[model samples]
Target: MQARQLTLDVTLPDGSDFDAFHAGANGLALDSLRALARGEGERQLYLYGEPGSGKTHLLQAACHEASLWGRRAAYLPAFLLRQGGAHALEGLDQLDLVCLDGISALVGCVETETGLFNLINASRCRDTRLVLADTHAPRALSAALPDLGSRLVWGPVFQLQPLDDAGKRAVLVERARRRGFDLPGEVGEFLLRTCARDLATLMVQLERLEQASLRDQRRVTLPFARAVLGEGG
Candidate 1:
């Protein structure tokens, strides 16, 4: 199938890369994913983690890295793929790397399950690396199709560890630096205490703060963050 025919025309989001992710205790998993992107090691990898544990980030980061090496790669979340039906996955093996996120969402959908199974087989034939992620272990989601579960774990599996509070702080500070700002230590602490701790939410709030800072011509100090975030007492 021609690339244009496929429903998956996802563009990797900016700042979603290895450098943007704070590996924390998942250093080994990060290394493995980097190697997979470069086509240096295993052809299939399964990653499981809780929300905000960096599963989606790493998957997209892998796709970005693979493209940097001139390999065609796509990061397809199963939720979005489901919207286009199982056929949306057709011909994905033509790419060098495919990162399938939220695989657990495909369990009850027979068409998607079979399509994913077939995609795995076709990927093996084409030597296309596949990276799949879910919030649960392979066994936990295998009740509907044991064979598919077994196939899911046919290669290396890694459970991404959730970052600790300190790690989250570091991520906020580092990510702010990447966006050309300084996230003061107290501001980070205040965000942690007052706002949603999930990296996704924190990042959104950070962008809001950045925009407000630029608009007001002020630094990202604790007072400015409080005012921008509306967390003032």
Candidate 2:
């Protein structure tokens, strides 16, 4: 099969705000990334979080920071890379940092599983930092390869807890501000009250809200939010 191309335009969230959803993160996730940034030992890190728990955000931020430090970092979603067959691992050795997201997708297949194992080994041998993100915990992955499971456990693992109601609201407000939309407090609260609480869903809702507000030439009010969300204002 031909290599399936998955291209996503990666950019930092806008606004002058630096408030991160992971601001309080001093656990394995933050520490491991910091270690890699500081050129310390333990170059491999594993991050586990539920969907929309900000795992991808932290990984992307790390990549952005690495770029500022003039280091080479490659972020690839594991699902896409695995679809390209084993040859995908060839050029990754050239990177200073490699981030793999959605790694659970590679669990069952022998070829992809072994390929990831080899990639991890190659990265270690080359002194490249490897970061892996998965929806489930590392020990819970049902991979058939015993060695692969062992390799995953070799890294420092962090579990990203789901954001509380306040945390989710803060994220929604910050994201809206970053996107150049003035989200009123009432509107933000309304969204959290009625829409999906996950970051991914909130992001999509914000994009829709932005379009609706622009088309109607009105600021984002609670009524507008509710009406646009089909919640019957």
> What are the TM-scores, per candidate, against the unseen true structure?
0.94, 0.85
Shift in Å, residue 208, candidate 2: 0.9
Deviating ranges (above 4 Å) for candidate 1:
2-8
Off by over 4 Å in 2: 1-20, 24-28, 34-41
Candidate 2 overall Cα lDDT vs. reference?
0.73
> Number of clashes in every candidate structure?
0, 0
Q: Could you give the C-alpha RMSD of every candidate to the true structure, in order shown? A: 1.8, 3.6
Clashing pairs in 2: none
TM-score of candidate 1 versus the correct structure, residues matched by position: 0.94
Residues 9-122, model 1: lDDT tens digits: 676778999998989889999999999999889899999988989999999999889978988887887667667656767888988988989887677777878888888889
Error of 2 at 108 (Å): 1.4
lDDT of 2 by residue, 151-178 (tens): 9977788888877777777777877776
**lDDT, candidate 2, at 128:** 82
Q: What's the residue-level lDDT of 182 in candidate 1?
A: 93
In candidate 2, what residue range of length 10 has the lowest lDDT sum? 1-10
